[model samples]
Target: MDAVERLRRLCIDDPVDDAADDPGWSDALDAHTVSLVRIGALIATDAPAASMRSVIDEAVTAGASLQEIVAVLEGLIGDVGLPRTVAAAPRIAAALGHGDDLVTDAEI
Candidate 1:
């Protein structure tokens, strides 16, 4: 299967039989850009801390500096609006290892 098809299956918890053979997401975009874009999507969706964690790790592994990641969040504010950005901030921060305290406080 193509890489995008494999990724679609993985997203829904389906197993890709030949996932090991897939070239992965870096075929088009570089790993670093893809990782940062994933982070932005997570932020835009107000995704949970657990979901953000892995993507953030991937971003870091792909050589995304903390500043660039933070810039992704900041840059989306105008597009996504303050409320969504605010709601997502703590989860993203927690995923980045800022502390669960931020998440807890955000919940309150």
Candidate 2:
């Protein structure tokens, strides 16, 4: 499966918990976030960006609004914290710019 599919399965199978889990939780979360950031960067490329944007735009057009997208992104950022999130934002923004009305608001 693709990284996004793998990530979806991971999310479905194992809900993240920093407190209840073992000491390795932080490392695992970091690894997962890094992988996602890489995927975001890859998706931002000219070839993949169009496809990715189309999917995201369809989702948004269906029911998901820009705020919802931003909330999901911010939640991911909250999970990973500011430093990592800040580092990941540009790539993610680039990727997201292809689809929904992402860059319109300053909140993202």
Candidate 3:
């Protein structure tokens, strides 16, 4: 299955732990899926100023709505915790806007 589909399945069908324990889970949860989740978590946690701005920019690029981004972050935080969620946020944001300027003068 495609990455998006696999992620959807992972989110809907099985508990995160069940999928995490599966050998193929990592393969299914591709970079994009992970990024989406991370971006979502960052937004939900009221991340650092730089981090929140970065995630918002990335989510906009990734075609993810603010609400969608928030949902993903909430899910990640609910499953994991603040630290991991925070760590993952920037990466996910970066993934969405790989070379783009996620930060702006106004944001800084």
Candidate 4:
């Protein structure tokens, strides 16, 4: 298992509610998509910023695009709140090799 998976397993207090996959769902949750979302969740939950960078790199290597990463972060705003999205911007920027971008508190 990867570092993220290890952390997730170690941290979860309760069992995850198992949901069977629905093939008809428009947005299928493939490995890459799941990785993208995992990256965002890590960011929101105050995992190391470097962790986000690493996961972002892996996601890109796994065929996820920058747009997809941004979409994940954007989508997270509603569920995780503005601060979490804002907190993620710098990490995302560094991961994308645009580290010079000045990410503000509300940048996302």
Candidate 5:
């Protein structure tokens, strides 16, 4: 199987813990890239707002800048569609500690 198929099996077919413990799949990429990709996956899937914190936190811990994180969200708009990206924005913002900004202003 190809990398995509392996990833699908690892993430969906295998047990969660097994997948987590196995670094073989992601070893090629740096932690920062992995974390950023996770952020993209979260956005693409329309994941729960509560789930955003840990994923964003991991991205930050892996040395991802706020710009990079936001870029992941923006970049996915083309692939995941505008609505999904927009829906994910609030969650991503909250995760990055700018949650209050959503409530405060309409500069755009």
Candidate 6:
């Protein structure tokens, strides 16, 4: 499963301009934006929560801001609903280093 994900990232998250030969396709969206939407779709489609952390990490490196990532999740609300959004929030937060299960929780 991890290997599948690694391959997916290699293919889907490649920052190279595969659009080099096609003008119309290349004109549509930037590579960073495309990577972000792919991550959003993975989230919306209910991919494993743990798997998303790495995807999110790659998206961040490719210039997708936290706000943009949240927007992608928000866009799914109409189709997937509030419950999914609620569930995904914590996962995303965890990836972003704000999960509730911090060392502070253990200290208390």
- What C-alpha lDDT values do all the predictions have? 0.81, 0.48, 0.57, 0.72, 0.81, 0.70
Number of clashing residue pairs, candidate 2: 0
lDDT, candidate 5, 1-108, per-residue tens: 356766676677663444556665466789999998889998889898778789999989999998898789889989999998988888778778887877444411
- Per residue, candidate 4 scores C-alpha lDDT tens digits across 1-108 of 344554485488632333234322224567686777678779679677678878888898889987888888888889889987777777788778876666644542
Writing each residue's lDDT as its tens digit, candidate 6 over 1-108 gives 244544565688753343355433345678787778777777677777677788888788889888898888888888788877666767777777776764244321
In candidate 6, residue 26 scores what lDDT?
46
lDDT per residue for candidate 1 within 1-108, as digits (tens), equals: 676777798899987765477546546789899998999899888887788898999999999998998899899999999898877777777777875655576452
Tens digits of per-residue lDDT, candidate 3, 24-96, equal 4466565446557655555556556567566556556657664666567557776677776656555545545
- Candidate 4 regions exceeding 4 Å error are 1-29, 102-108
Q: Give the clash count for each candidate.
A: 0, 0, 2, 0, 0, 0
Best by TM-score: 5
Candidate 5, RMSD to the unseen true structure? 4.3
TM-score of each: 0.69, 0.33, 0.35, 0.64, 0.76, 0.62
CA lDDT for candidate 5? 0.81
Q: Rank by lDDT, descending?
A: 1, 5, 4, 6, 3, 2
Inter-residue clash pairs, candidate 1: none
Sliding window of 10 residues with minimal summed lDDT for model 4: 17-26
**Better candidate by TM-score, 2 or 5:** 5
